[model samples]
Target: MFTQAKLIITAVVLAALIGLGTWWHLSRVHAAEKAVHAHYAVVLSEIREKTAAAVTAFRATETAWRSAIDKEAANGQARIDLARHDAAGARTERDRLLADVARYRTAARTAQHSSAPTAGPTTGDALDLFADLFSRADARAGELAEFADAAHAAGLTCERSFDALSRTKPATVQAPQSNQ
Candidate 1:
């Protein structure tokens, strides 16, 4: 009876120890799983945040790029408009100069045909009038040349600006951060 009693007591204690060890091991496993889940959550949250930031930065860059394009387009258009205006003015001046040249030629031809016979007051007056007409024609020609030069310069400047604008490249988008 005493041996039987000792065996039963030992068996009960062994069962209790087994149950306690299993509970402890299960609790440890549960804690490990919880920690893993928490780490994954943190990593996922970081990834999401980085993605959001990258998207925002990309949008801002796009907006800036668009604005720059718009401004450049406007500037280019303005340059073209100015060049056109200058060209028109040059044309008008050239036409006026041509008309003046025709008038001067006609006047010279008429004067040559109607020269005075003797050196009298009429002859001196005719000479003075011819001199004044020649001077005025020379001044008009100079003005026409200046207008041509200015128009050419303006056209070249506008073309250069257009070429520069075409050559310009937009800024590249930055790569997003690694989620590792």
Candidate 2:
């Protein structure tokens, strides 16, 4: 009976020790898991901050480039409008001068038939007007050509800026996978 009692006590003590050891091990594991989770949270927070900053910088750069392109386009359009206005004015003036020449020619023919010495302005005056009109038309054409060249240059610059913007990489955030 004494030996049985001793053996029973010993078995109880061993079982208690084993339970205590298991509890201690489980607590340590839980602590380690908590520490790991805290570390991951800190890293994730840093990543989010960096990603947000990158996005902001990218947006600012994009806005600047777009603004520059728009300004260039507007300037080119203004130049084109000015050129058109000048060309239209030149055309109207040329037409008016041509009509004046025709009238003068008709008047001179009528005067010759009627045996009159006086007609209209001298031929030199008509020739001078025609030459001046031709010079102005040529100048207007040159202005139009310059406007076209400027517009093409602006278009090319805008295209290059757009291409650069497109090539820029966007910010990305990758989520951690769950073990479960």
Candidate 3:
């Protein structure tokens, strides 16, 4: 009977010791898990904040770029308008000069064809045709020159706008020279 009682008491003490050890181990594991979770949460929050900041900065840069392009377009339009107005005014003077050219050609032709003894020629065969051709060619050249000037001004304005928007220098392009 005494030996059985001693064995029972020893068994109870061992069971209590095992329970306490299990409790201690579980508490340590729980603490480690909580520490890891907190560290991950902090890292995740930092990543999210940085991403938001980066997006905002990118949006600002895009807006500024758009504004720059808009400004360049407006300036180009103004330049084109001014060029057109000036060209139109030049056309008024050109019209008057063309009228004077026609009047002088008619008078010269009449004087050459006259057989009058007072003023001028008795014959005008090929010279009259040549004079008419020269007058026509000179008037056509003047018209072409004015058109080229206006077109060149407008083209330059467009090129400047493109260069400004693209943030580059003015690039020159030469036409291929024709052998003819």
Candidate 4:
């Protein structure tokens, strides 16, 4: 004979496992996310360094071009072109990185704050956490899509700019003829 008490007990046990599994999965996801964030931080630092170098190089070339032209006649269109290309590429990369950071921040926040809905067990003491977990997972999925788009666009733009910059000639100014 099926008894109400037995059925209730069975339901509670099932709910407990569901809650535990949800917690475990979410914990694993959080760990993986932390690793991803660490890797991204390193990459972001590298990107910043590369962008700064590109900017410095561009500025130096600009200064040289200005001084050369001001002192004597010099055409440094190639250098100017290259500098423009570098700046544009850096801007694209920085923008993409910012986008990725925004997505990650949103995901982390959602994970930390969101909670799953629950069915009140007969004991009414333990709450269901799986609902919130599901919500967080959905949020992460959305964030991942945005991150992927930014990465793809940034990669394509960087590749194109690098190709263009590589083909450009280093601008040179011949010393003005001196009738000494």
Best by TM-score: 3
Each candidate's lDDT (Cα)?
0.69, 0.71, 0.68, 0.58
lDDT of 4 by residue, 80-138 (tens): 44545655575566567556655765665565457554464322121124334544565
Per-residue accuracy of model 3 over 6-44 as CA lDDT, tens digit each: 999889988899999999999999999999888778777
Best by lDDT: 2
In the predicted model 3, the residue pairs found to clash are: none
Which residue pairs clash within candidate 1?
A: none
Error of 1 at 77 (Å): 1.3
Q: Please say which candidate is ahead in lDDT: 1 or 4.
A: 1
Identify the superior model by lDDT, candidate 1 or candidate 2. Answer: 2
Quote the RMSD, in angstroms, for model 3: 13.0
Looking at model 4, report the run of 10 residues with the lowest lDDT sum.
121-130
Off by over 4 Å in 2: 115-180
Q: Of the pair 2 and 3, which is ahead by TM-score?
A: 3
lDDT of 4: 0.58
TM-score of each: 0.57, 0.61, 0.62, 0.35
Candidate 1 local Cα displacement, residue 25, angstroms: 1.3
Better model by TM-score, 1 or 3? 3
Instruction: Give the poorly placed runs of model 3, Cα more than 4 Å off.
Output: 1-7, 113-180
In candidate 2, residue 14 scores what lDDT? Answer: 96
**Which pairs clash (backbone N, Cα, C closer than 3 Å) in model 4?**
115-132, 116-131, 116-132
